[model samples]
Target: MMQVIYDPLLPWAAIWASAAGVVLIVALALWRRLPGWWLRGLAGAALLAALANPSLQDEAQTPLSDIVVLVVDESASQTLSDRAVQTARAIDEMERAIAGLENTELRVVSLGDAPGDEGTLLMTALSEAVAEEPRGRLAGAVLLTDGRLHDVDRAPDLPAPLHVLLTGHEDDWDRRLVVENAPAFAILDEEVTLTLRIEDQGQAPAGDGLVELDVAVDGGAVRQVRVPVGEDLTLPLTLTHGGTNVIQFTTPAAEGELTDRNNTAVVQINGVRDRLSVLLVSGEPHPGERTWRNLLKSDSSVDLVHFTILRPPEKQDGVPVSELSLIAFPTRELFLDKIDEFDLIIFDRYKRRGILPAIYFDNIRRYVEDGGAVLIAAGPDFASADSIYRTPLGQILPAAPTGRVIERGYLPELAPLGERHPVTAGLPDLAPPGAEGAPGWGRWFRQIDLDPRAGQVVMQGVGDRPLLVLDRVGEGRVALLGSDQAWLWSRGFEGGGPQLELLRRLAHWMMKEPELDEEALTATAEGQRMTVTRRTLADEVGELEITGPDGNVTTAPLQEVAPGRFQAEVTGPEIGLYRLSEGDQSAVIALGPAAPREFEETVASGAALEPVVARGRGGIVRLEDGVPSVRQVREGRPAAGRGWIGVTPRHAYVTSDVTVTPLVPAWLFLVLAAGLSLGAWMREGRR
Candidate 1:
């Protein structure tokens, strides 16, 4: 190709000034009525033109192919119904049409669902594809999706028209249950309200028809209830236990619903105790008296009600009871009236005396049998005939004390069962008094000898006697600590042990915290990865049964990470609720969200991309009718018609080589100017 180019000998500013001078000279000559004024003016114009150089450019060029982006949506929502099939067919037809156009290149970019619970990001994918290609060569962009994009604000500035081939029928619909709001943490035993509603999308059924809902907590017995469709249901939920409570709400599939993936929702509410009321009845004010008190009082969440038996009835100090500073013990109020109000009752070195009657002891036994917790920190009193175990509570007590109490120093060690028990499973070993190179913690000097009759002995003391025994009686839980020197650890006697942590776990376990369950199943999610944990008291665990958001089941064997702690991890391909179970234990953990954002709206629509399409002068055509024919359209013109989608012809090219030559020699311009001047002069002379 040859084109005129220029390498001016003077600056444009100087050239423009010379042209103005020439024009002025011509005007003055014509005003004075000079002979041959037209010829003279033409010569001056040619002189000014010589100063401004012009050249002819010849070049070798290569025509670059025009790029047409075909963005296909393979997101989770598009996989439902016939949208997947429609998308596949559209891609094939668009590819064929683009191939037929000369100098046109097809760029296919497939957009799947975002990681975890994030919805389809079709605009994000489009912006990336545009950035990778040359903007000048972009002929147009075509989207083959259902138009349920979550990142519409990230739409790219298009150089050409943008067209969309919509999938799915207009009549397709879906019924999804939405959990509008739920508290992440709720007070234990308090009612928390959950805002929920069943929504109808597209052509979904609408009416007052009842939708059956099954609500379960930690995979317990499901409570069935019927709620009207499309109405907000404020369901009252109460957390039964502390720690992570999985509350699953599920509704059976409605007739003609698109999919049941959105019909179920899982909510995890962490239950926290408002305040733990502990009634501490101390038999005497010993050195360890402040140990239990400090442990309970240091925790701001615990309300401690401590009472010490300063003087027994058998020991008379010759002081009147009314005049004494000691406050009267409210046995009737504590043992009978408000016993159930206390979460834990700790008897610190408390021996049976004339203070409480046999009926009161029976009442205490009944309290424990009815889901109450008790901790017996025995001392020398446990071996006495007046021990509380000799009363009605003895029937439920885990161990019976011998007639002797050993006062020799002994190192407390974890029993074999304790290695598997949740309470003392991972406790660090402490130095025993002054022995061993490992720097073990403290040791107790007093341990009450006892013979275990029921329950598991988790810790042992001198002569392998039960130091800590945990048992379940009726619906309640109890623990017995055979020594009173737990305070030695608090005093840092030969480097303190894990007394605080041990007591904390013991208290929480007795109170029935779900995480401290001896045998349990739980799951945690981070992005697409899910870590499944199975905690048990046995030597080994079997394979875990995992049910996905869909009804499909997958089994993965649990690997023993620690003693009695088994784990299995799997990365989910999609997002939604998952059911994990092993034998009689089960847990429901939502991998992404209760109701995934992808499934929130399953119907196909072009509303999300309408603004983007309009800005590029493109149109949306439904594939349900037929595949639109591809055609070329001019810039700024509508790129779609009834049955055709248009792609703009960019005519992009690159120059490989070029040569520049002056259009005419400088000498030639001077000769032309002189000839015209002489011709005018001869004509004037002849006239």
Candidate 2:
């Protein structure tokens, strides 16, 4: 390209001097009535033009290739129906067409599934690709996707037109199950509401018929029910255990459905106890009496019903029974009437005095065998002939006293069973200083020796005698603590131990906490990562079987991280539901959100990107018709036709070299001015 240039011989000051001379000459010609006045004025203008030099500039330019963005969607939704195949074909054809066009290049930007359930972010990907190139070189943007982008609000202001080559057939449709709202935590044994709906998108079925819906808790049996389509259904679900509860709802795929990925939904609700009612009966007041009361009362969630036998019926010091301040024991009300109302019944150092009848003890035993929990914090009284073990409750007790109570001080240590038992495992090592084992906690005096009749021995006292034993009778559970000196640890004797934690775990275990189950298989999900764990009393566990959302089964060997705890982890490629099983135990875990964004809407449509296309003067073309032919169009015009897509020609370039010279020489201008002045003077003289 050539342009004007200036090289002044005398600066702007000389232009002013020539202007004055021209004005004076023009005035003299007009005043003298000279016939050549016009010629004289023209001569003065020429002289002034010579003083102000001018030039022409010429440069060499090199053309720059236009940048055309081709965004390909590889998100999870794009794999539905024929969208993937359409995208592959469109990408190949577009690449070839851009390659054939002179001074044009294709910048391919492949977008994968958005992280953490965020759907296809086509606009975000396009903006990034455009940012990598110069704005002046951007020809236009072309996107190949299912048109279900999640981040359309992030679309960039395009320098050229933006077109969308939508994948999938125009008549594609999908039926999906949606859990509109679900509580993450629910009170155990209480009914909670789950809001769910079933809807059809795209070219849905013509009828408003009922669909078969199946619901299951944890991995239990599935219950099926017929539910009307396209309406929100409220489900009343009750939790059974105190821990994570996975409630899965699934609907059979309808005919002509796009994909089954959205046909099922998982809702993980944690079961929490509303209030734990504990019946605490203390046979006689002792140092540990306050300890037990303080521990139980410290927790606001526990409703404690405490009764202490201040005086036994056998004790009489010539005092009138009617004048006493104590109230009569409500044996019938507690042992028979509302026994099942309480979750756990605790007996602390009770001897078989004449206070209760044999029928009452029998009822207590029946309560234990019928899904009720019982805990015995035994004292020296258990070794006596009148011990409670000698009563009707003895049949359900895990151990029987040998009628010997050792009065010597001894350290309470965990037995082999306790090492693997969830109640005692991983407790703070309370071993005293210079002890053989870590956390050799404090010591206790006076241990009641007992022989195991049934169940497992979890703790030992003097001479390796059974100090703590746990057993199950029918559907209920029982635990016995042979010594009453746990209060020594509470009093900080020789440094305190994990007395509070130990008691808490024991209480929760007796109440059937799922985390404390002797044998269980469970999984936890955080984003796409899953941790599978197997808790068992056995020393070795088999491999853990995992079933992914895609129905693929894989087995992962569990490594013993603790005495009886085995665990392993796996990361999934996509977000959805998963199942875990090992031995006879199984569980279901829902990774990521309950309803992933990718499958929230599986039908393909152009509604999301229509506004963007209109702003860029671009058109939406369905890939079902075929990959549209590429054409070069002028800027600021329509860029799409029946079967063709247009890319605006930017005509962008780069400067290589440049040459500038004067348009006319100073000597030529000066000579022309002098000739005009001489001609004007001769004309005046001739006149």
Candidate 3:
């Protein structure tokens, strides 16, 4: 509703102005003797009315029903180091404080963990709470948390007073360890580097010294390295063996460290190389010559160097040395000079022709003894009296081939123990999803009957003869594939075999891939599910023991996911590195990337809401002690002191216009003037 009032018709001020104009006009007309003086006065009065253009306006406001907003952060980080207990106390105090105020409603909202991202976003929660109710009805806002607000910058600008019920003590502190850089896998026999960073909670001491760093591979102590603290250091790792090398890097806890759980880290580097460097030495050319070369050369990454001894040491071709098509082999260059350059050394069917001096064979034997891989594809000569077995190389050869070549066809199959070896383990099945049927493989038609001197028989031939065997010399690995007819499997001799894939895995495993580790300890993370696997010769292991962010420990049973491997899935209660243990073995698996949102904004400062607080003339009160009461003060006045905070009423007002009148009509005014003048004239005449 609205109303308007004003002096419009015959206003005295307007009337006086009109009369003055008329009087001036009349005086001028009388002096000049002009006509139409009254018409000019009428024109002045008409203009005055248009200039006034007057009206009145007023409004009535429906006062707000006061409401208080309470934002609570219950994210993962809040559960850290006693933050949860503080938050619960603050919320209860706020509920009791707001209950004493009249016409006030309490709205409580709890913020939980955010997926993928970290921390409690106090500002965002407050913004949502302000939006849920009417803006005019907002009384004030209160946030309860450990001051670790990740999205603190997003704090809402509240129209009403805002306060912080800060959680945690100013003296509280914590410490954590960080593994900065860990390679997915390290190359076999090649040095790989890792970086680690250590951090202190609260204020760090001025001086810190060398820390003990231990490297464990497949649960064996390869080395114990001493490294400096604070700065990052590159730790060298030479993957001594192939397959998934579960390398655990650990640093013993210091005297006052908050927790030693984060001091250890477990990383599974999947051992692999784009290509392998193979050196194939052949005493003479044969059908298998192209087979070994083609198999290796087909892969672009595999660098193959093939050498065949066509000229015997004793009998050089009688023709002129220059006339012979074959060039003299540089025995020193291949053996003594750069033996370590190749990953694998293969000796295929060489007799006692002595192309390489006895010293060269001795070096070859030393080569295998010192961290090198050797494969022997024996032929008919392996059974002869003039076999390389008669030379210095006999010491390293796993088996002495019987001077017998069995041309009988037989399906190359794995020995009983081979079924559990990472190379041949889970074979006969292609899909790893399930072990029902891995892959169907073809058969090899020919095999060499050999006598296993000292080696594990991985494959057997007719009459249960050892067809394939493996042995270790010094730190080196050796494999003996008894026959050259392996290519028969590649040609689909018996239902298209996995010969190619099998050979590939066998070679890589011998080279030591961090992926196919037989005895390994590892951890994997995807969302909330974390998988911990322990691969060992032991038939079974106890359930995984997990220590959560809050230092709570629980054990979960592990199920056999594959042969010789035990696995368990742990749904983490909070985001941070979780400690997984069984017996003396423990692994620090990062559950999520960083601290959850609740701990992001760790400082309990009011800078985020200072500007809005000033605009509303409101002050903030900390919740560490207790929440002060809420009381309304004068507009632009303090409601509470620095210890207790609240808002003051603004004393707002609306302007209203007043209309005035003399209780006299236009005709009555004219009559009164005329009668007064007439009476004065009569009295003067009578006098």
Q: What is the C-alpha lDDT of each candidate?
A: 0.87, 0.87, 0.67
Which of 1 and 3 is ahead in lDDT? 1
Pick out the ten consecutive residues of candidate 1 with the lowest summed lDDT.
430-439
lDDT of 1 by residue, 209-231 (tens): 77799998877799999988888
TM-score (C-alpha, index-matched) for candidate 1: 0.93
What is candidate 1's CA lDDT for residue 426?
Answer: 81
Question: Candidate 3: where is the Cα deviation over 4 Å?
Answer: 1-65, 76-88, 153-157, 171-276, 315-317, 321-326, 357-359, 430-441, 453-455, 533-558, 561-566, 574-588, 593-618, 633-641, 647-687
Q: Backbone clashes per model, in order?
A: 4, 10, 29
Better of 1 and 3 by TM-score: 1
In model 2, where do residues sit more than 4 Å from their true spots?
7-52, 99-102, 320-323, 428-438, 670-687
Worst 10 residues of 2 by lDDT: 429-438
lDDT at 1 for candidate 3? 28
State model 2's lDDT. Answer: 0.87
lDDT of 3 by residue, 190-267 (tens): 888877765555544455567777777755644777777777777777775554556666676666533454565666
Clashing residue pairs found in predicted model 1: 430-440, 430-441, 431-440, 431-441
lDDT for each residue of candidate 2 in 234-311, tens digit (9 for 90 to 100): 999988887888888889887898988888888888899999999999989899888889999999999999998877
TM value for model 3: 0.71
